[model samples]
Target: MSKQNFVIGLTFVIGLIVGGLAIAVWPAPPLSTPAGHALSLRVPKNRQLLDIAISPDHSLLAYTAITDGRTRLFLRPLNRFEATEVTGSIGAAQPFFSPDGTSIGFFSNGFLKTTSLYSDGATPITICAVPGTPAGAAWRADGLIVFAGPGATGLREVAATGGTPVMLTTIDQDAGETSHGWPSIINDRFLLFTVGKHGYDPRLTLLDLETKDTRPLLLADGGGFVVTPSTLVFARRGELFAHHLNSKTLKATTPKNPF
Candidate 1:
């Protein structure tokens, strides 16, 4: 073979080998394990741990423990199995991690707070204050916060940066036979968690942020915990399902007593 052709062939083979080596050398993302490793011996029994939330990075787990009819936020490391109380405030509900995992967003004292996990009393920044109890909280990918509460007319959206929250849902919008509870941002749209007489008919609906075009994602399933525009993880009955935001596909990924 000619020297020119031989040199070209050798270069191409070297490039292919280098490309594979690069991939092998790179580090992999952290893996998430189930939250019941340490409690295997102590409290081998698990009950309905409501309002479970993981840090944005999936490093921390925050959930509400409804013991004796009172709700409190518990923070536990997602890696090692151990639970701790993060807040001692009255009526603390729905503790969620910030998208950056640097802080946690929760509702207490009729207001939403952003607390840093790495510091001691690092000053819980206020998101907004409303009338009812634990106002709903959901963090956006860009760090914007959205909380739901019964407004003078209906549900509203208060900014996480501390300001007025504009009403995002109408009083007339019905969920089975009830009103809508706004959850989080989905597909650059709004997702509301609504309950009715039909035994927790969670739905995945949409509203055009710019044009206000309302639509349904899933009609009669449980609500969604959306992580991105084209992806969502939702719990129905006792199972978790992954939803493709575009194709509308549902795939279950959970064990016994899921959701």
Candidate 2:
């Protein structure tokens, strides 16, 4: 088998027990990993980090840090650097930078407001276009911003500067399957989100802008996917997954469970 195929085959398993907040889903079965291990890092004790954003050039990473009823944004250089608290005591999470690297976007409003990042510690400009809680910002390559929100379908999108947001999912759904995880961008024109269901399972879907279609990538837990310059890295169940953007091949990336 090709290395990429082997990577996908051994990356992640969709069916495993996470066990939190009444976690339950349709059994997708456990997948195995034969490839080498993907690197892993533990979230700081008592501080739950979520919605990680790696820069397009892969130079830095930003994510939300929450604990003790407080939330803030953190940043870390990818190479041999400890993560630093970027904004302390700010009710911010789910951060994404603009295409030009001059600005960042994250939800600041307790009700999910989009705020732009600036260097001079200036007040963040609220982008009235998108309404969100935590999972409210995704920066596209062209500087267009998309975010998940509450509306007819529990998610919406707007531009970076601000304007009328077009709902991504036509069907009404919960914001997250578990614990309000943010929507992940699959590519420039596509994204991945979940539709919550009771007594059944949350639906993992890929959103296509051109077709206005949300394709099912998995049943309940196919949410997190990181896009490197050349590949897309994801984790599922007890393993990791990768899809090469250049070759357009899907593979398992981790030797063990990344989640």
**Using TM-score as the measure, which candidate wins?**
1
Specify the highest-lDDT model's number: 1
lDDT of each model, Cα atoms only? 0.53, 0.51
Q: What is the TM-score of each candidate against the true structure?
A: 0.62, 0.60
Model 2 per-residue lDDT tens digits across residues 1-259: 5533432233222111111001234334326622222223356787865555655544556666677777777766645347766643277755766765566677766433334345444556666633443444567776566666653354666766767667555554353333223465655666666655545554555667667765555443335454343444444443454454443422223323233
TM-score of 1: 0.62
| Over 4 Å off, model 2 | 1-51, 66-69, 79-89, 111-118, 129-136, 150-152, 172-181, 220-222, 226-259
What does the lDDT read for residue 159 in candidate 2? 66
Candidate 2 global CA lDDT score: 0.51
